[model samples]
Target chain A: MVIPITTGKGRSSRMHEFWEALTDPHVDFLRIALLMGLLASLAFGMTGSLVVVKRISYVAGAISHAVLGGIGAALYLQTVHGLEWMHPLLGALLAALLAAVIIAWIRNNGFQREDSVIGAVWAGGMATGLVFISKTPGFVDPMSYLFGNILILSRTDLYLVSILDLLLLGILFVQYNRLQALCFDEEQARLRGIRVGWYYTLLLCLIACTVVLLVSVVGIVLVVALLTIPAAMAGQHVRSLGAMMALSSLLTLFFVSLGIVIGFLGDWPAGPAIILVAGVAYLLQSLLKRVAA
Target chain B: MSEPAVIDCTEITVRYGPVTVLDKVSFVVPERRTLCIVGPNGGGKSTLLKVLLGLVRPQSGTVRVLGREPRQARMRVGYMPQYVQIDPLFPIDVEGIVRMGRLKGRGLGFYTREDRMATRQALEEVGLWEQRREAYINLSGGMKQRVLIARALVNNPELLLLDEPTAMVDAHIEARLLEKLKELHNRMTILLVSHDATFVSGLVDEVLCVNRTAEIHPVERVRDKSVTRLYGEPVQHVVHGHTHHHGEGEEQPDA
Candidate 1:
């Protein structure tokens, strides 16, 4: 039940009902959304910061969109052949990783322009997914994949997100300094004996996995906005990458939590609401800075 | 016994698609000696530096640095690129940029005490210690070049490679930087690419004039005529009063 605002005794009762709805163990949807929001902040904060700083948001967008191909393939196999072990998320991870590798290779080795390569993969991936989904012989809501319904998340999705989040966090923690060098000057990073090629590939691969995990929360279409907006805001005010990451994560938490609550109350899509909140926050921050100046 | 050449390249040729950048070029820098590579834009000066760094593989060449392939000796070589293209909005301070030099040997760990000390000494040497906490992207162009120099210096490399270190600095700062390089030259081998022929004349032991091909000339032999020959056009040397000043005296080539 959506909470209703009132000025009298009815307000108090509605507040109690809202609290009960959140606390009720049987109504796990809100709890899942809350957990997803927290995890999204932690994951996107780090990933988004790197994505923006390295100027690879376009690459990330390509990988994220490419995951749908895998999702569709997995669904087709599972539904048609009764392959119970083939999870859609697994398919998505593989698809994203493959797309990241291909995109990076094209950007590095191909003489052609990078945007053209990314553009081709971007549309090709979605078309591939659509073709597979159409042939699945049953009613599968594309909205769930294209525009994520966080309220419908299963425990499995949370597990997948958590495992991937830990992997991302672990990789970042281990290679923080190397990443800093890579981000600063890749040529110098190479002279410093850091394998620039390997690290770049690893980073893109990590982005691929991160995109796959985020698809269930923000969907494929809005994930880039969710990934970049908070981190971009934090980058303006912070002096170190570590500080930027911490601040971005906190901002993500604020935007995601507020957006989830607003979406629940106002009956709107949570992902778009979260991105809208972040965009508005960024605008407000810029305006405040301009005014102060 | 004399030390082997720090850098030894024999018949090096580099090509990018249809264009041949460095055509069958050869040069060597003796140990503890400084060499200045003079050439016009797109004359493969930067490409030469990349080859030495093993960043660019030559189409045909044999390159040896400190008795090994350039790639093998890359860890022991400190390279400062021509242009510092770091985004102005990047969130990195001076100390952080300087600390990146120490990231060579260590893998996936925090900076060590030695790393910190090296960063401090490098920053202090460049007179940027007070501004160590300042953002690198906000620094003046000269200051930014010095910061990059400090990054190169932090590693205590056997061979220091600088690409147009003085290109962005003013005349006064260029003079000071030259003095610093003179002092630094006594300790390690330096190979720098410069657009200004006269800036490093007194400082460099020898001059390697690079066009599409290459030639090693004695400091005295590198006159205004040589620069005209190098760029294939009369050079309007900026900053210095002399039209072509290749270090005041006649220092004979030992190449």
Candidate 2:
């Protein structure tokens, strides 16, 4: 259900309407959407830091784009094959993990030029997703999945996001040192007897999980923006990875919250609004830093 | 007889798809002695180091580092790679980088108090303890190289392998690093690889020259014959308190 915008009403009334929609017991989708955004910020902050530091934003981008294939397949399967249990989110997770593993394998094995393989996977996954999406029965709006509607998210997505956040935090707690080593210097990590290949694959898998979490908030097309922008911004000011993660998490939370408010106020799509705030903030920060320097 | 060998390799051969990088190379480095492997670029100096680090497996060879297989002895061996392999923009500090040396394949655990202590000691040893909190990217090239040394020393390993530690540093930093290595020579076995013969001439107990094949010569023998033969060109040889420039320049004797 689209939240009706009081176009002719004053700004205060619109905010009141948003606040009421959030607190109303009978209508808690807005509250749920806000909670989903906040929880997803944790995963985004951490994984995005890793993606930026390891210089694998391209790999993360590939994984995010590839998620479309899984979403499309799930939609097709549920509609055409009568597989009621095939959730699009599950399909997205699987496809993301598969794409991550394949990319990691190619990188470890040196089977092909890594960029070429990444390019193929990036384009191939999108094409596959589009084909499956078109083949599905009924009038499904692909735009909703390509660019998400956080306002329409269900309680189920919220639970999934919470669970993923916990899993990501737990893994990070245990593997922080190794992951740091892997990102900093794989060869030294190897000499220190850390399994570089396994850790690399594991890092990618974590990135995959984070991408799926992001998909729920920003959809497929804009997922890379949210995954990278806040982290990049945080990297500019922070001196260490942990600090970068914390600062980026706060930045993501800020952008997400402000974007949601702006989207609600203007009756705009929340995802793009969030990305715009983040993009503009990043540009302004860069300009300020340059001027100050 | 000589001291028990800390590094013993017999007929080790490494090839990358028929391009033989190290062909039947053999060398022995005794305990507590510094061995410098000097050779030209693409002469398998780095490849030989990888073979010892168990990073590159040779086609046929028996290799022992600290009397055990390279992989088995990896935990007790510290390695500083030739290049600073990390991105300069990486958000890590000197302490963070050095702490990586304490990772021991445990898969999941934080650094222990002992790990912290070792990191401090390593940093202090390299005279970078004051700058431990500094951003690695903000450090000078010399300090960055020193940080890598501190990382390799953090574990207090029995063997330290440094590949071209003086490659990019200026002369002042090189002398400082040379002094640091001299102090370390009293405790651990050091295997340093460099293409520049003059830089390592004073510190090494022996020189292992490699150009696809390998040969070991005493430091005294390196001044005239071995270095000249290995590089296939006349080069400067710095012996104790003396400098000899071959082929085109006069020999300048130092006090």
- On TM-score, the candidate that comes out on top is 2
Which pairs clash in model 1? B201-B247, B202-B247
True contacts kept of each: 0.73, 0.80
Q: For residues B1-255, what per-residue lDDT tens digits would candidate 2 score against the true structure?
A: 778989999999999987999988888888998888887789999899898998898999899999999999988898987546668898988899898888877646589899999999999999999998999889998899989999999988899999888777777888888899999989999999876566776788888889999988877776544566667887765543456775444653110
**Per-residue accuracy of model 1 over B69-158 as CA lDDT, tens digit each:** 999998788888754566768888899989988886355568889999999999999899999999876788878888888999997889
lDDT of 2 by residue, A49-82 (tens): 9999998999988998899899899999999999
* Model 1 CAPRI rating: medium
The reply for model 1, stretches above 4 Å from the true place, is A1-20, A108-113, A290-293, B1-3, B105-108, B240-255
Q: Residue A228, candidate 1: how far off, in angstroms?
A: 1.0
Model 1, span A1-293: residue lDDT tens? 12233334454565565577689988787788889888878888898899888988888888888888988988999999998888888888888999888887776676678899899888888988888889998888777788676777878878887887899889888898888778778888888788777778888998888888888777898889888999999998877999888889899999988887766665578878887899999999999999999
